[model samples]
Target: MIADEIREQIDAIGIERGRPLLISDADEVLFAFMAGLESYLQGEGLSFDFSSFAITGNVKDADGMALDREAVRSHLGVFFERHTEALDPVEHAAETLAELSKEAQIIVLSNIPLAQRGARARALARHGMDYPLIANEGAKGPAVRLLHDRAAAPAVFIDDIPHNHASVRDHAEDVHRLHFVADTRLARLIPQAEHCHARADTWLEARPIIERHLFGG
Candidate 1:
């Protein structure tokens, strides 16, 4: 399932020689995204409509008028531009990821835009995390596959979205998939995913599973 250009990209990164641990998702996985977004919306007298999983159609003003797609995009661009460097890490994420790095080559493969890459890296570094960060633009499946093919087996995949978990599961069944739900309220809104090997509410809950899988019980 890996393509030639992607293979070249992975080869360039040199994932083949080490045990890779892909700790990912910048928003809800590493930082408190839902709260930040809700705070942003409230300032605009807007709130999540709770009608769907996506943000574009779900964000609505107090009068219940949802922002148009372009407006939503514009708002997001502004939001990330200002707050990318200020986002707080998910409680316990830095320490957990730090501990895991002792045994595996940890890299963050995120869907964050290229424009925000440096700020995101700075944000993570400020939180005591200093790992390689890959800012991707499309469905994460292709990147995950590229990593899987070029790296050693038994890779670990962590993301806040179920679809992402499914994407990795479909692409590389051997890769360990963890569903990390950060915002308790929105977490409750998302149903349990059968494809995800584990569902984690906090980095603490995910720590042992990762350690056990990597270090062996």
Candidate 2:
């Protein structure tokens, strides 16, 4: 089961006691996935509708007809396979996380395919975010709980998806949740989640908010 696999991966990471844990999502948190993906799609003569958050319905060909679900999925796979290690870091993500890492244990919880995990790790390392990366699938509630169980109290979860934030809220209510969406246009489209402590589009604004919650600064 996915939950068992995630638990094994978390246990293998060997959490440090007496330190706060920061579980962050990679796409739109540490790296610009939507932006990079858009560029990649453009190259393939396809584009997004920008009106919907879901990719399958949003991705369209030059004729403006939405691509089939399978085609969209295939395009995503190809995009990740070829461009996983070449993504641009979200603004101030590396610097802010590096500062936070001094006081907290940082772990990247991404929903990328397992095959691209190596490339994602290499990319983060290249961007000076050499932290432990965990590639997961489906809802992140169970995995977040496992990580929280191993770390000190007052853990923080940073992600762009409201569902993931809600999952953490349901599974680990004590953990602080930060809803981060890096793309300005996309951020405007997303409503603030009731469970999130704060919703931010840039790390500059996010850093202070997270610091206050985690360190009481």
Candidate 3:
């Protein structure tokens, strides 16, 4: 399932080869996605409940009622379309990744719609994260596996979603998983996944851990 998706995207963008691959997620891990989404929602006269980890059920109206799943999905599309290029980078993400790139091949694996790929790439590059960006959908296990196959061991995976971490854990067991969420408020709301090597809210904390895991420092 993910092989076909990976083949399609990799064929389009082409992959770079290097030792010790770092497959990372853009939202939450590198960019402040939930924070941007919340601000976008506020502009639309909506806001998140922040009480729940999931977005679909947590997005609320002025009357404090959750929007239907379809509505939330539609709003997400609009949010990305309007704000993807301008979303702020998570603290220390650009600097840490720039440093880490010297030691490992850094590839951003984001679960964003394919249409926003160019915009996202441009945005990341503008923020000094000019690494390869792969826009994918659904579970990231197969994609991570394929990426790992291209580079030397040990592959590292970083994402905010537990399900994505679980996917890598199941399909690419050797890949080190780092569960990261940039927003402090939302970070506290999320529970750490058992499959992850470490759960971090900032790149400052995660950089040392990842460096140690991959470089044996």
Candidate 4:
């Protein structure tokens, strides 16, 4: 759900009434998160085993021992803290959003820690995505719902996580959801989320769908 302060942030965004809305996830969808994490893990003498969609269970030490959830979380914390401002963007993600922003009020609804929100925004701005960002903590359903309600327009939600799609569907039944995994390697391992309207592996394939959904053909 959303905390009071986070709710305030979402409300503070200047969403034009009747303008289309695009709510996007930062990592994996906009930034090359998994790739950056894998490289960081290598530096820490650990490796990311892309066996499944789970990050915690897939990380292994040099001895090939799986890291516990807490350890994995710690690594992720350090990874984001140290590398948030430097991670590369997914191909064409910024360009596509910029094009979409001509008609849509865009907001990055990433699951990053609130403390790193400014760093993430600065990094995104560096890549030409200067939209307002909401650093969310838990399920994105309620936040997506709030954004949708405020915009009062056809909204599109792009994310790589299936659970977030389900959460948005549950909280905001009308928001169009597209499951987008920009990393080809990660896309090969994940199935299309049932709750999502479509699965787009790259921004190339996703842009048209969002345009068609928000602006119509």
- Provide the clashing-pair count of each candidate structure: 0, 0, 0, 0
lDDT values for all models: 0.77, 0.89, 0.87, 0.91
Cα lDDT tens digits for candidate 1, 28-147: 888898788777778767788766667888888778888899989888888888778877788998888877787777778777767888899898889998877777665567778777
Model 2 — which ten-residue stretch has the worst lDDT?
1-10
Model 3 regions more than 4 Å off: 3-5, 11-18
Between prediction 1 and prediction 4, the one with superior lDDT is: 4
The clash tally of candidate 4 reads 0
Task: Write one digit per residue (lDDT tens) for candidate 3, span 1-217.
Answer: 6657566776664556547778899998888888899899999999899897889889999999999999999999998898999999998999999999887888899989889989999999999999888888899998888888767577789999999988998888989899998888888887898789888888888988889877888
Could you give me the TM-score of model 4 versus the true structure? 0.98
Pairs of colliding residues, candidate 4: none
Q: Please list the residue runs of candidate 1 whose C-alpha ends up more than 4 Å from where it truly belongs after superposition.
A: 1-13, 50-52
14-102 per-residue lDDT for model 4 (tens digits): 77888999999999999999899989999999998888987978999989999999999898899989999999999999898888888
Model 1: weakest 10-residue lDDT segment is: 1-10
Query: Candidate 2, residues 1-217: lDDT per residue as tens digits?
Result: 3466677778789898768889999998899999999999999999988896678889998889999999999999999999999999998999999899899899999999989999999999999999998989987888888888878566889988888988889888889999999988788878886778888889999988888877889
- Candidates' TM-scores? 0.88, 0.96, 0.95, 0.98
Error of 4 at 136 (Å): 0.5
Q: Could you tell me the TM-score of candidate 2?
A: 0.96
lDDT of 3 at 48: 91
